[model samples]
Target: MTYRIGYIVGSLSSVSINRRLAGALVALAPDTLEFFEIGIADLPLYNRDLDGDYPEVARRFKGDVESADGLLIVSPEYNRSMPGALKNAIDWGSRPWGTNSFARKPTALLGTSSGSIGTAVMQAAMRNVLSFLNVPQLSSPEAYITFKPDEWDGDMVTNESTRAFLTHYMAEFAAFVERVLAHAPGHIGDEG
Candidate 1:
């Protein structure tokens, strides 16, 4: 069965490397996976007051999260943590009490940065938040890509080793998603 995967790119920059990395991952993904971006650029800073009467954009964001069979969060490190825009989107998805849109959604987190360590710290912080929301995540084959202009050709990874690793990561994530969904209550492919 095909899986509808919603991806969030944490950077708001028009020329974001993380965005390019996300594109490469999508291109390398299996045919059974369909990737779509979940835009976080327009979401306002989340506030509890607004949760009572969620804005149209917030509603749309939540709807996107709810409809997806799986999620991929591609983030960039900002001051040793996740970008503000990404945090804002996460807050919107987990708000209004007992209405977490990310609950039980199979997720995989990866990020790219110019530094050698990449987005390790930011991913750690994100893991805490997503864990609290009960989002199931793929924890293995952690990707901490160091952005290098020479290693990429537009939206494709030109480095042979990096491309092979990313391709393998995508395959692993596809299997993880399918396994999680098959066991989810009332899922279409559920055999139990």
Candidate 2:
């Protein structure tokens, strides 16, 4: 069975490496995973007044988040926290106080950075946000990468070991989503 997974990128910059990494992970997935991109860049800053009844763009973004069986967030650490654009996307999804799209969804986070730590701190920070939003994420086998020039093609993660790790991680995440959805029944987002 194929699963619809949301691949959310944190950065809006035209040259976002994080977005490229998300693309790479999707490519690494076997035929069983159907990954979709969630547009965080086009969304306006979230406001409660816009909840439920949303603008066209907000509705589209929310639909992507709400329908995906699981989430794969590839973020860049912006000033020690997640990028405002990414947070805004999440806020838009986790709205109306109770009808959160991510409530109980299986999610995973990975990031690539120019810095040495490879967005590790940002990953930790996002865990708190995921907890509050009730999105259950894989806590171990953390995924992170420090960008190395001449090491990767655009939208391709080239490190041999890192690629292997991510392939394994994604398979495990697929199983995790299957387990959660089996127990939760209809809560598993869109099973497309």
Candidate 3:
């Protein structure tokens, strides 16, 4: 069965290295996983006042999150933290009290950066937030890629080692999603 995987690239910049990494990861993913981007560029800075009546864009974003079988967040580190736009999207997805779109979803986080540490700091911060949101995240094979221009050709990771690692990561993610979904409440496989 094909799984609908929604991915969020945390950079708004057109030339974001994280975006390229996300695309390459998608290309390396298993055939059963179909990926779609969940755009965060247009989401306004989340305000509690808007919670009572969420904007159309925010509603659409929530719908996308709820519809996905799993989620992938690819982010870049900015000043030792995740980009503000990505945080904003997270806030929106977890808001409107009791309507968190991310709750119980099988999620995976990975990122790329020019720094030697890659996006470690950013992914750590995201892990805390996602934990609070009750997201079931893939905890193994943590991917923190350091971007090397020579190793990449546009949206493809040209280096054999990097490509192999990403391929394994995607396969793990696909298995994680299926495992989570099989046991989810109301899933066909569930005993109840």
- Pull out the clashing pairs in model 1: none
- Ordered by TM-score, highest first, the candidates read 1, 3, 2
Each candidate's TM vs. the true structure?
Answer: 0.95, 0.91, 0.95
Model 1: residues with Cα > 4 Å off, grouped in runs: 185-192
**Candidate 1 to truth, TM:** 0.95
For candidate 3, lDDT tens digit of each residue in 16-123? Answer: 999999999899999999999999999999999998999999999988988888999999998888899999998998878878888888999989998989899988
Worst 10-residue lDDT window for candidate 1 reads: 183-192
For lDDT, the strongest prediction is: 1
How far does residue 5 in candidate 1 sit from its true spot (Å)?
0.1
Candidate 2 on 110-181: residue-level lDDT in tens? 798999999999988999999887788977678778988677888887788878987888888888888878
As for lDDT, the candidate ahead, 1 or 3, is 1
The whole-model C-alpha lDDT of candidate 3 against the native structure comes to 0.90
Q: Model 1, range 36-97, lDDT digits (tens) per residue?
A: 88999999889888867999999999889888999999999999899999999989988767
Model 3 clash pairs are none
Number of the candidate with higher TM-score, 2 or 3: 3
* Clash number by candidate, in order: 0, 1, 0
Q: Candidate 3: minimum summed lDDT over ten consecutive residues — where?
A: 183-192
